[model samples]
Target chain A: MDWQAIRLSLWLATLTTVSLLVLGLPLAYWLATSRRRWKFLVEAVVAMPLVLPPTVLGFYLLMAMGPRSPFGRAWESLFGRTLPFSFEGLLLASVLYSLPFMIQPLAAAFAAVDRGLVEASWCLGESRLRTFLRVIAPLSWAGILTGVVLSFAHTLGEFGVVLMVGGNLPGRTRTVSIAIYDQVQAMDYAPAARTAALLLGVSFLVLTFTYALRRRQRKPWTLI
Target chain B: MDAHLTPSPQLLADAERRYRGGPTVEARFDIPEPGFSVTVLFGPSGSGKTTALRLLAGLERADRGSIRFGGATWSDAARGLHCPPQARNLGFLPQAYSLFPHLSVSANLGYGLASLSARERRARVDELLALLDLRDLEARHPGELSGGQQQRVALGRALARKPALLLLDEPLSALDRPSQVRLRKELRSLLRTLDIPTVLVTHDRAEALQLGDRLVVMDQGRVCQCGDIQQVFDRPTDPAVATILGVETVVRGRIESIVGGMATLSVGSARIFAADPGGLGWEVFICIRGEDVAVERGSTPGSGSTARNRLPARITALNPEGSLVRLSLDCGFPLESLVTRQACADLGLSEGDGVCAVLKAAAVHLIPHD
Candidate 1:
C-alpha cells in the first residue's frame, strides 16, 4: 500500500487537468474557428503529441527543463527550486504529454457547433465573447467534460514522461505507476498487483464515462 | 452635389463576392424610403441570392465594391473596410432556424440583451413571446419544440435587438412543404406587422411573389432586374429573368408582321399578338403567367372582348398543385392554365379533352431572346 505515491499522483493529475482546461479552451477554440492561412500549421503542432513517441517527448522535455536551460533557470529563480526531478516538473510534463486528449475533443466539439447559430448570435448584436458564453459554451459542455475526463485519465497512467521529469522520490515526485514498478523490482508481487488493478479499474470507468457522454451528445436532436 | 440636397438612399449597395474559385456574384441596387418595404433577392439555386443577402448582413466580405446603409459605410473593399455582423444593426434568420438547443425559449430570446439589466431583458423577452405567440413554449428547449415553434424562437431572437433591417435566408425552407405552404401567408403578415425594412433571399417563386414589395431578380451571379414585384414579373428584363420568375409559358415567336403597335408573332402553328415592346427585332420570347390563362369548354365559346387569343386546344396533362390543377395544353404551342380543382371537376377536364384556351393580349409579355 503506497498511500503517499497514490496521493501524489492524484494531486498531480487533478492540477494538470485543471490547468489543461484553462489553457486548452482558448487554444482548441482558436484551432477550431480560426480562418488564418496558417491555421493548419497550428493544428499540426497541437496534434504532434498524438503521433510523437512518449519517450521522445520525455527526452526533449528533460533537456528543456534541465539546469542549463533558460526555462529551468527561470523556474528556479521564480520558485527557488530546480524544475527537473520535482513534482512541478512532473506536472508540466503531464500537461504537455496529455494535451491532445483535452484539445482534440474540445476542438471537435467546437467545430461541430452549427455555424448558423454563431452568425445568428452576431446578427442579434451579441459580441463574440457574449455569444460564446451564452450559445457556444452551453452547447459544448458535454465535449468539455469528455476532454477533462480523458486528460485526467491520460495524466494518471503516464510512465515515461514522469520518470524522465520526476525521478523516484516517494512523497514529493513518485507516482502510483512508479510505486508499482518499484514494488515489482523488489519482487513484491502482491502489492504491485493491487496497485495495477486499481489503476486499470479507474481508467476503464473514466473511458466509459467519456464514451457515454459522447454517445448522448451525438444524437442530432440534442444539437439542432 | 450638396450632402443636404440629396439625402443618400437608405441602403445603396454595389458589390461583388466570390467564394473560393466559384462564380463571382455582382449586385447593384438602392433602397430609398425603406420604412415598410420588403426587397427580395430572388433566383434559382446557385444564383448568388444568399451571397447577396450575406454581404448586406455583413456576414460576408465582398471581393470588391461597397455597401452603404443609413449614411454609414458597412463594407468597402477598396478602402479595406469591413464592418462585422455585430455592428451591422440587422437581424438575420438563416435557413436553419438555429435555435440554441440548450437554452429555454425565453433565454434564447433574451440571448442578445446582455447589455440590458435583467429586468429589462425579461420584459423584452416577454414582449417577444406575446408578439410571436410563443408564450407556451417559453420554458421549453429548442429540441423539445416543433419546427414551426423553433422558427418563431429564432425570429424572436433576431428581433430582440430591434435591428434596423431584417435579413431572412429561405425563412420557411426548414419546414416540410405542407408547413411551408401554410406558413407563407402567415409569415408575410408577421413581417408586415414587424414594421421593419427587410431584405429576403429565396429561390421559391411563390415565396418571392407573396413576400416582397420590391424585387431584385438575380441569375448566374448578376442582378438581372429590379423593380416593383408585379412590374418585374410582368416585364422581366431578359429570358433568364423570365425563367427564374417561373413564367408558366415561355415560347419562341417570330414576327409575322406589325400592325399598329401590335406585333403578331407566329409561335409554332398558333399566332399570338403582343403589344410591340419594340427594338426586340423579329425574334422574341413570350412569357405568360399560368393564372393569366383562362380555359372553358370549347362548345360554349362566346365572343368575349377581354381575351384576344382563344385557341381551341387539347389537354396534354393535368398536374394537381395544392388548391389548383395545372392544365398543360397543346394549343399548337404548349400552354398552361391554373384552375381550381372544383373547376377542373366541373369542366370534366382530364388527360385528353378539348377546351378553349383564352389569353388576353395584354397578358403576353415579350423580351428579346438574343
Candidate 2:
C-alpha cells in the first residue's frame, strides 16, 4: 500500500478546499449580488460544470494547462515549468471541478438573507463590509460549512480530472483514487479493496458528520 | 423681562443622509423645512412613506435631494456631499421591528454602543430595558417575545444610540390592533421626551394624525400637502387631500342668501346654511360629516330648534353602526346621517320613507371654488 498517494490526495483535497473558498467567496458574492452588465453570462459559465460531463471539463482543463495555450504559457513563464503531470496541475483541476460545489451553496445562502436585515444593519450604522462579516457570514455559516464539506468531499472523490491530468507520478500526482485503479490493474486485489473501503468509509463519515452537525446547529435550512 | 432661549446643541447639529434612490427615507434637516415640527411623510401603500424614512436613515440615497440634521448636512447633491448612514446618527426602526434574533434583549440593546466601556454599555442597556418596561425580558431572545414585546426591544435597540434624528418606519404596524394602539401611545411619549426630531412614516391617516406633529402628504413621488393635521383637515387645498384625509362629503351648491354673515344655500335637493357668507348664485363646496345630520319622521311639525339647516329627506337605506344606525337618504343628492338605534326605533324610520334632516351650520365646513 503506497502511503504517498494517500498523502498526496489529502494534500490535494485540502489545497483545493482552501483555494476554492478564497476564490469562490468573492465569485459567490458577485453571483449573489452583482448587478453588473452581462451577469447572466458569468452565471451560465459558472454553472457549466454542473451540467457538462466531468471528462469534457477535464479535457478543457488539459487544453488550458497545456503549453499550447496562452494561460499555459503565462503559467510556464511565471512558474518556470509546465502545469500538467504536476501536483500543481492536480490542484488546479480539483479547484475547477469543485468550484460549483463551493459557490452554488454559498451564493444561494447569501441570496437567501433577508434584504431588510441587511438594510436595517446599514441604517443601524454598520458599514457594508462589517454587515457582511458580522450579520451575513454568521447568518449563512451553515451553508458555508455545507459548501466547504461538499467541495472537499467532491475533490477527494475526483477521478476523471485527476486521471486525465495527473499522469500518476508517485508521491506527487498519483492520488488515492488513481492508486486504487493502478492496484486493481496490477492484480493487487487486497490492497485495492482496502483503499476502496477507506475511501468509502471516509466519504460516508464526512457526509454523516456534516449532517449531524447541521442537525445539531438546527440552522434554518432553505430550499435555494 | 425677555428670557433668552438657547438653541438645542442637538438641534444646531443635523444628521446627514445620502442616497442613490431605491426608497423614500428620512433626511436630516439642519435647515429645517418651514412650518414643520417633524415632517412625517405619510400616504397609502407604495406611496413612498417608508422610502422617505429610509432616506432619512441614510440607508438609501436619493438621486436628488438634501438631508440635513442636527446642524450637519447629510446629503447635498449640488454641493457633492454624502454621508454614510451610520455617520448620520439616525435611530431607525424598520417596519418589521427587527431585534437581533440571536441576542437576548439586553444584548440587542447594547449592540449599537459597542464602542462604549463595558460598565457604561451595561448601564445604557439596563436603562433602556427599564425605559421600555422590558426589565423582566432582558435575558429573553427575540423569538421568545410577543410581537409587541419584540417591537419594544427593537425600539430600545434604536434608542440606545441616542441618535440626533429618529426615523420610525411603520414601527407599530406589525403588531395586533390593541398592541398597535398601546405601543403607538408609548412611542409618542418616548419620542417627545427625546427632543430628537423624528420622522414617522405610515400608510394610515389615523396613525399619521395620531403620531405626526406635522404631516407631509406624499402621493406617487411628489409632496401633495404638508401642514398641521387639523389645518389640513379643516381646509384641504385639493380634492386629493380631501379624499386622503377621509373628508369625503363635498356638496356643490348655489348660495341663495347671505343673512347674519351666513350663506343659506340649496345643496343637492336640500336647503342648508353654512357659516361662510356669500352672494346669490355663488357656487361652493360644503363639507358635512355623516354624523351631523339628525333624522325625523315625515311631515314634521315646526318646533323650537336651534338647528340652522333642515331638509325633508327620504331614507333610502339603513346601515348598522356599533349601537347607531347609519341612514342613507335621497335629500337632493345622497346624504348620509347617523342616528342611535333607539332613535331609529322611536322615529319608525326604515328604508324608502320620509324624514326631516336637521343640522347646524357650525357642523358644516365650506370651501370656495369660484
Candidate 3:
C-alpha cells in the first residue's frame, strides 16, 4: 500500500500550508492597500501559477534548484544538502504551486475591510500593526480560513510538480500521487484503488468543512 | 487642579496641501482660547473643511506648514518634524461611525485605552458607557445597534483615551433629522462634560450656529471669514462667505450714493438701503437672510413700519419647509423671505399677490463682490 509515501505527502502538504500562511498574509495585505504603480506587476506574477502548467513551472524550479545555480550552491554549502529530489525541495515546490490559493482570497478579504475602520483605529491612537491584528484579523477570519483550507487541499493533491521536483524516491520524495501512479503501472489495482479513494475522501471532507464554515458565518446565531 | 492654574495652550495651524486632481487647501487657523470649547469649520461640500481638520489631527500632512498646540509642535515642515496620528494625542470621529464590527460595544471602547492598567481600562470603559448612555448595549456588536447607538459607541471609543483634543468630521450627517437633533443636544452636553478642545467639521450652517462658539467659514480651500458665530453671520467678509452662510437673497448692486454712513444701492430698478461699513467698493452685494426679511400683504409703503427699506413685490412661489414657509418675491429683483406658518396664514400670502418686503438697514449687510 506504500503507507510511508502517504505519510510523507501529508507532512509535506501540512508544512507547505503553514509556511504559505506565514508568508502570504503580509504580502496580500500590501497588495490590497499599497498604491504603488508596480503593484499589478507583483499581482500578475503571483497569479501565474493559477494558469501555468504544473510541469512547466516544475521544469523551471528544477533548473533553479540545480547544483550549478547560485542559490543551489549556497544552499548546499550552508546545509550540506542539495535541493532537488529532497523533501525540502518538494515542500518549496508545493508552496509555489499553492501560492495563489493562499493569497487571492486573503487579498479580497483585506480589501473588503472598511477603510474608515482602519482610519478610526489610527485616530484612537492604535499603531498599524495593532490595528491589523486586533481589528482586521478577526473580521477577515472567514476568508483566511478559506485560503488555508484550499492551500492545504491543493498541496495534498499535487502531482505533476511534485513528481518533476521530488523524483519518485520511496520514503524520501515518493508522495501519495506518485505511489498511485507506481501502483497503476505495476498492475496493483487494489492498493491503487485504496489510495485513490483515500485522497477523494480527504478532499471531500475539506470542501465540506469550508462550505459549513461559510454557511455558519452567514448565520452567526448558529455559532452560539 | 494645579494644571488649571497655568494658562490653557492654544492651537495654531498654518498649512497648505494640494491634492492630485483635487482642490488645494490653504488653511491658516489660530484658536487662542482652549479647554472644552467646540470650534466649527463650516463651509460647503468642497471647501476643505474636512481637510483642515485632518491636517490638525495629523491624519493628513501639509506641504510646508507648521502646527503648534501650545508648546508641542505637531508638525513643522522646514524643521522636518511630523508626528504620526497615533502620537498626536487626539481623538477623531470620522463621518461614518467607524465602530469595529467584530468587537462588542464595550470592547470597542476599550480598544483605545491600552495605556491604562487592566482595572483602570475597565473603569474607563464603564465610565464612558455611562456617559454615552450605552450601558445597556455594552454587550452588543455594532451591527446590532441602531445608527444613533453606533454613533454614540464610536464617540465613547474616541473619548475613552482621554485625548487632549477631539476632532469630529460631520458626526451627525448620517443620522435622520429627528435623531440628528436629539443626538446633537446629547453630544453638546457630552462635550461640555469632557472639557477638551474640539474641532468639528460640518457643511450645515445650523449645526455651526448651535454647536460652535467660534466659526471659521471656508470657501475654495481658503478661510473666507472667521470670528464669533454672530459676528460671522452678521458680517461676512465677502459675497462668497455670505453665500455659504445661507444668505438666501444676494443681489449685485452698484452704490448710487453714500449718505451719513448709509449706502443707497441701485439693484436692478429698486433702490436698497444698507449700512455702509465703509471701505466697500462701488460694486457690492446686498446680503439678506430669508428669515430676516418680513413680508406684509397690501401694506402701504413706509407706513406702520420703521424699516429703512420697503419694496412692493409680487409673490412668485411659496414653499412650505416644515413649520416655516419660504416665499420667493420679485420686486424688480429676486428676494426670498421666510416666515412662520402662522405668520404666513395671518398675512394671507399667496402666489401672484402683491406684498411689501421689509428690510431693516441693520439687517442688510454689504459685502464686496468677488
Which candidate, 2 or 3, has the higher TM-score? 3
Q: Candidate 3 - CAPRI tier?
A: medium
lDDT of 2 at B348: 80
Q: Backbone clashes per model, in order?
A: 0, 33, 0
Q: Model 3 chain B, TM?
A: 0.69
Misplaced by over 4 Å in model 2 are A217-224, B1-38, B77-81, B248-288, B295-370
Model 2, TM vs. native = 0.75
Candidate 1 residue-wise lDDT at B316: 88
Candidate order by TM-score, decreasing, is: 3, 1, 2
Give every candidate's TM-score on chain A: 0.93, 0.93, 0.96
The window of 10 residues in a row where model 2 chain A has the poorest summed lDDT is A215-224
Per residue, candidate 2 scores C-alpha lDDT tens digits across B1-370 of 2225554333321222334465433333332432224546777776666666666665555556665555577777667777888788778888888666656789788877867899999999889988989999988878899988888888888888887677788887888776765555567667778877777778765466556666677666556676665456555688687667664354567788877878778876678878863322365556677778887677575689888777887888898878988787877866778789998998787788987888888887764433
Write the number of the candidate with greater DockQ, choosing between 1 and 2. Answer: 1
Model 1: lDDT equals 0.85
Of 1 and 2, which scores higher on lDDT? 1
